[model samples]
Target: MLTNACAIIATAASAQIIAGRDASADDWPGMASLQTVLGHSLFHECGATMISPEWALTAAHCVEDARIETGGRAYQYARADDGSLVRFGVLSVAIGAADLRRRGAGTVFPLSAVIVHPAYKPEKPEAGNDIALLRLESPWEGPVALVDGLTVVPREDNLDGPPLVVAGYGRTEEDGPGEEAFSQTGRQLSAPKMRLQEGYVPFVETEACRQQIDSLVARYGLSDIYTDVAISPDSQICAGAGTTDSCQGDSGGPLVYRDYADPPVQVGIVSWGLGCGRPESPGIYTRVAAYADWISGVTGLQIAAPQP
Candidate 1:
């Protein structure tokens, strides 16, 4: 399965990890797990990053249909084809959870509001504007360490120059049923890891990323529903190294620019990729830096524009 977002014709992407190592206990304090309850079980669906005590950042598609109303209330359910509200499950985020089964006190927070980018296209997530923010029902009272390295605004210049890190509780392997199966059934099969996983990938230059994706389309004789642009440098970041890349359960997760000496700065949100860990194809992420103004306007928290 493709581990990113959109499915390209017969090509596809899921929400998890492809090839990554198990994250140490203190690797990422702000790292979070986007989960949904099913009967007696809470399953990890996507990865998220806590940006503030009451807010988290994730990919729009990961929230299914949770949206903010015109009057600022959050509508918490997806609608059926006939326009009736459908409650699949309750969505929540878990912090300070190295192993999801052993969630610690004050680590989980129920979401009160969901704000998906207005221009987000569900059918074509790869086209960009794939970011979203979730408001917690109450301020996070988890361990202070969890909020120590909150994601911040990214640098405007040299996005491709930084060493990047991606962490999630998504699948460590990239094996799954195809996208056709997901369309038939409302959900994709997730072989998620119980423990968090982290990996590093190099940022691919925009033109090079586009050429690689185009080559994949031609090689597979595939047809794409969203072909306006395969990879937009202004809205997306492309990064991968050999087979070290994010996969199925990693969507909405942070792709941060990390330097050993300083706190990591989130640069992108995991969106989509042609296939997981394919050397020739790289993962595509929603460029967080590009949406700084929109995020600030929605959150009412001042975020400085990237400086040269």
Candidate 2:
């Protein structure tokens, strides 16, 4: 979540953009922004990745109590009935190159429906089942490939985890002037555009995630803040502690691999963390490969493997 007024109230501080730089050089045709609109204005509360022509994946928390700003004021909105922070109906989306840095420029679309994983329980702190699928009113004709398919790196191959690329339009930094540098663009409706930042961080194995979390829990006396699903092998990936990590508005975006030449395949979804980029707090992302079959069921589409 964001520490700023208009920033997302996610795990709270949309976190610090830190070392992540502009992602314009990278080709992410499947990129999408889940906009939290108020009246006639809109602001991106979280990042989303289009996994299919009609589906975009993001964190359920992104839409829950999503942050918004209008008339120079910022506030949090959540309608438990619809599981969205916005009151009105119809959430808007911009797919096929929806870059915030580009001033919300991209293919605009309407959300016909939103389906959060049935198992997901937002009240639980363990961060269980944070994944959700936004059903586009229609389908996207974007250049990026849908992230659905059987192509995935097995858990056994997760040795030492692996490096991945993350992108989003969140707070630029944890604190100081840089933090508010983008606040106007990110939270204010004046410009209504924000900068998109990206970074590469290696995935931490499940065992490692548990160990580190345990140590941190006990050391910091944070047992009351964590849950069994915090870093479960079947559901999450812990990545990067201090060097670089995702935070705040970065939630619900894609954690993908860039080693392959055929664009990149998303392996994780931005979940939660203790705070921003603390030395002991690693970013938690929802493991994507673990839910391939579930995705197919939701979209009624086949999973395609990432090609080299």
**Which lDDT tens digits does candidate 2 get at residues 1-308?**
43322232224214335577777624665776666545555656677887767778888766554333343222435665555445543366666433443443337676766677778775443556788777766677765433523344343556254557777766555542322223223543311125667788767767776776677657755565454545686777777766577766777777776665556777778877655566756777787777778878988867665457
Q: Relative to the true structure, how large is the alpha-carbon lDDT of every model?
A: 0.68, 0.61
Residue 155 miss distance in model 2 (angstroms): 7.3
TM-score to native of every candidate shown: 0.82, 0.77
Q: List where candidate 2 sits over 4 angstroms from the true fold.
A: 1-16, 64-90, 96-106, 145-156, 159-161, 176-193, 218-221, 227-229, 305-308
lDDT against true structure, model 1: 0.68
| Per-residue accuracy of model 1 over 108-185 as CA lDDT, tens digit each | 777888888998876467767878898888798643222111235456475666788887766655664312112112
The runs of at least 3 residues in candidate 1 whose Cα sits more than 4 Å from the true structure, single-residue gaps closed, are 1-14, 67-85, 142-153, 176-191, 228-230, 305-308
Cα displacement (angstroms), candidate 2, residue 195, comes to: 1.4
The alpha-carbon root-mean-square deviation between model 1 and the true structure, to one decimal in Å, is 5.9
Candidate 2: Cα lDDT at 25:
27
- Please tell me which predicted candidate would have the highest lDDT against the true structure: 1
Model 2's TM-score against the true structure = 0.77
Go through the candidates in order and give the C-alpha RMSD of each one to the true structure. Answer: 5.9, 6.1
